[model samples]
Target: MHLPSRPRVATRPVQLAPRPPQLVGRDETVAELRERLLGSDVRPAVVAVHGLGGVGKTSLTLEYAYRLQQEYDLVWQLPAAEPAVLSAAFARLAALMGLRELGADAADPVDQVHAALAARTDPWLLIFDNVPEAEALLPFLPPVGPGHVLVTSRSGRWPRDQGLELPVLDLVSAARLLLSSSGQDDEVAAADVVSELGALPLALEQAAAYMSETGLALSEYLDLLHHQRAELLAQGQAWGYRERVASTWQFAFERLARTSPQAIALLRLLSCYAHEAIPSHLLLSPLERWAPRELFRADVQRRRAYGRIPGPPARLLRDVHPSVLVMMRALPRDTLRINAALTALRRHSLIGPPVDGAVTVHRLVQAVTLDQLSRRVQRRWREVAAVLVEAVLPDDPGQKARWPRYARLLPHIRTVLGPTSPGMDKTARYLGASGDYRTARSLFQEIAAALAAALGPEEGATLTARHELALWTGEAGDPTAARDQYVALLPVYERVLGPRHPHTLTTRHNLAQWTGRAGDPVAARDQYAALIPIRRWVSGPEHPDTLTTQANLAQWTGQAGDAAAARDQYATLLPVRERVLGAGHPATVTTREQLAHWTARARP
Candidate 1:
């Protein structure tokens, strides 16, 4: 037989019938692929089915190949992994095609098969199975002829127009597969089983086999699967004719480790963060630290070249595959463990495409990863009370407002700082300053009692605690006790913050106000006069607080029967207020009103 020199191009399209052991759960995909194959307009004619391992890429191809058997004179299923094995299989296929001489040379069997398919006057279909690497089969691919080539592989990149990405089974399909395979009649239970296995066909098959072996109900099987993911992974068992999904994952893991370790580490660290979607910046931080010097330099230069500015650190990170995230989070606990996990995640494609300039992991994956990390990393909770006090206690009302949340955490805060640390006093003061007087009073009492037990009643903290107790007691409506606390706190404020300090001035002002409220304007006038110069020197004359102090001093002077001096002081303040604040401003207006009242009194 004279073989045709050029590859035959089929003018008539092949009509492929749907075949039995009817491939379940991929009706849409199979039909689509079939229509594409039969369509007259298709060029560079080929169809490739690709997915993660054991997601039925090969099975779908076989079912379709059998469907089209009658349309082609020759059908061949060539294993693409081993070249020699593939050549032998093709040699046998050529013998069946009546091209017996084509098998003689092992060195060029692919070219021989190519020629055989090209020469055939009748149309043919060929199936290439497990072709994980596309480059290996480029030479073996049949020449364009009255024939079709169908390829199954994990790799997505194939002849541009010929690729078909096969997704895993959806829940309904997975349930159907389980029920059919397990011979189980419970539809509800089957769905529950499918959901637990992530609705992946490979997982469903494994579950079905487990159920078959044990004669277990689908619900019971689901529970076993839920509780035994790691155990199942450890056992390395296969189900029906399918290899274990865990083993497939391990293969992918090994491949990734060999090809890209950085991606792997990035994947792991991302498992620690809470957000499902994380910014690319999270990966960039560690990459800046761990990447090879030249690669790091190139990465930076590439970003700079593109005018791509990096963003702030990520608040959250998530993963696509919860299992992969779990594996990442299972790393050993150490200072560098989270960092290592993040590196692993980036190496693998567990993290999805960047969205709105942020890298995010899925929430489900993040939850699983965190659980795994908790098992390995004993979390180190820091004592935040001291830092919180420092951040919060600077006479800033904004900072003081945050004290309630901190105060509620007092018991935990106490343990973090150790029971006897000075942090407890600061914590108490924070509560007191924030107006959480009841809690502050109780905490102060506890501190005083504790200090009295450890040191003595005269100790600084104990004395301060007594002072706080007196203030709270006064605030709780006992004037006598409040006076006693102010008396007690006065010396401590002077001793600790010093007499000229703003804190000391505040204590003195509090005592004066309490005395006035207790019906002694004479004593209040003396306290008010002492505070005026100190307030001016410390807070500045134009300060609202200093102006208020001066106003209070004038009122006290008037109350003590010195209306003339009080009138002069109020008159002096009116001009100062107008100069510092505009005439229409509230403070200036108030001062004008005060001066008018005092002047009217002076007329008497």
Candidate 2:
């Protein structure tokens, strides 16, 4: 009897692009890929790798294929960015598999290829590169059998547990890539280059390629990167990449512009901010709601008047430019629209997946996006960003409940409005409130100097900055320095703001507090005593500030060595504090504690 012969399976050539000439810093990922695809008990193990454009998804997939190709009887890579192109590639793949006759006989060549792979017992590997949608490849994927499937995409819509998101290269690997690709020996310059490029592998490679071709030193290349960013980013083509670094992102931007104009607008707005985590709540909230009315008034005032736009000028409302009016009216107010825009950007990997209610765009993405904008457009968005940030700040920065919000918005405020912005003073106060008094003091110092230089030493803004600097100095463990600073500032405050100004009175109060802190309790007591009647007269007897002054006077009097007087003073003030500030108020609680302590001391 004769046995039936099995059908002969042809050996097909692996069609992977050349392996990245050198794979740097992906040992762990490569290992994980091996375990996911080869170690699985499930047949035809499937995995998808996704990440930002230019983050090395393709390079990583290629490396994995090249490293382990020998384990498969057949390996093929197909570009899946477009349906028509992918379909044609499938036809070519059919021809390669010697399934041309079978495909020609069938209505769909892709279907024939899928069936052939399904029936085969020989191990196979198929890679789909640049897939824009996971469902687009449903028809092209071979069924479960003796094969494995790998996919790379910028989209993150792959099935859970089957997708791996690739991040940019680590700093060390990024520097090594730059040094090796450029054939340069400057480790320091290489490090700087990688940092500027956001440790993105494609950017590092393109930068290296440009340096290698031009023979420019790393430092020179870095200078060009800063001064001629758009030109430099558009210049170089890496060996294996069809598009330069800028083009890689430009394609995504163009796609977004076509599919979701709102997403493009959001990305431009984000470009105006520092490359830090942007809380999603900021975008979803109505722009008018986050941007206080005063911010627009200030903006319009600056545009109309030639000099410093001081305090909120209600008069500026009528003088507002038509353009400013349009911008205000155009402020984004639709939460659904904003959420959809965020989804669109995330779909293209233009922004990272939202973590803890915030998202981050890569620094390079920010730079390239800004470079593409007209100067006028850039300025408009920046103004919008600043206004939004300023509006979100709490009315009371020193409130413990509001400190977390301050922490979240501080980096954005500093970047959008600069260190000298009036909002920054609140941020400094927040830092001191949160107990980073040293940073608070240092930041206030910078603000004071900048304000003095820009607005003159005697400007109201400058005096306020100086006042904050002194207050934080006392809080930051330098009571003597704070005392001396207040001493210098009080006369200036009196001269410029007048002795009766609220600012002048506040300065007096801080001076007294710091003097007590600096070890002169008697002087502090006397100063408070003098300020009490004036505060009471200026701010009403039961006003919070007047009550604060009285409370401070009692504490300092006790410190000046009259415990009985302090006990009686607190006894008198405690009911007033409880009545005005509420029985549960922090000040009321403290007054009760102080009364009990001074009462006990009086007994001795």
Give Cα distance to truth, residue 517, candidate 1, Å.
Answer: 33
Provide the RMSD of all predictions against the true structure, rounded to 1 decimal. 14.9, 6.0
Point to the candidate with the largest TM-score.
2
Q: Give stretches of model 2 more than 4 Å off.
A: 1-12, 39-43, 101-107, 184-188, 288-308, 311-332, 419-422, 453-456, 500-502, 529-604
lDDT for predicted candidate 1 compared with the true structure = 0.59
By TM-score, how accurate is candidate 2? 0.85
Per-model TM-score on C-alpha atoms? 0.49, 0.85
Residue 223 in model 2: lDDT = 92
Q: What is candidate 2's lDDT per residue for 329-417, written digit by digit as tens?
A: 45345666766878888888889887876889999888888888777767777777876676667768789999888888777877887
lDDT of 1 by residue, 1-604 (tens): 0011122233432222223343578878878877877773543258877655667777787677666666767656666756776777677656555566654663455566678667767767777776756677787787667777788776645666787767668777777888887888899888776655556566666666666777788877767657766455333233423356555545545665676555444444444443434433422333233322332234334323322223221211121223433332333223355344443443233444345434555332333333334443412112111222222223332375656445444543454443233455566667767777776677777777777666566555555567667676666566666766687778877886688977678778878766765678888889989888889888898888888888888877878878888889999888888888789999888778877777777776
lDDT of 1 at 470: 67
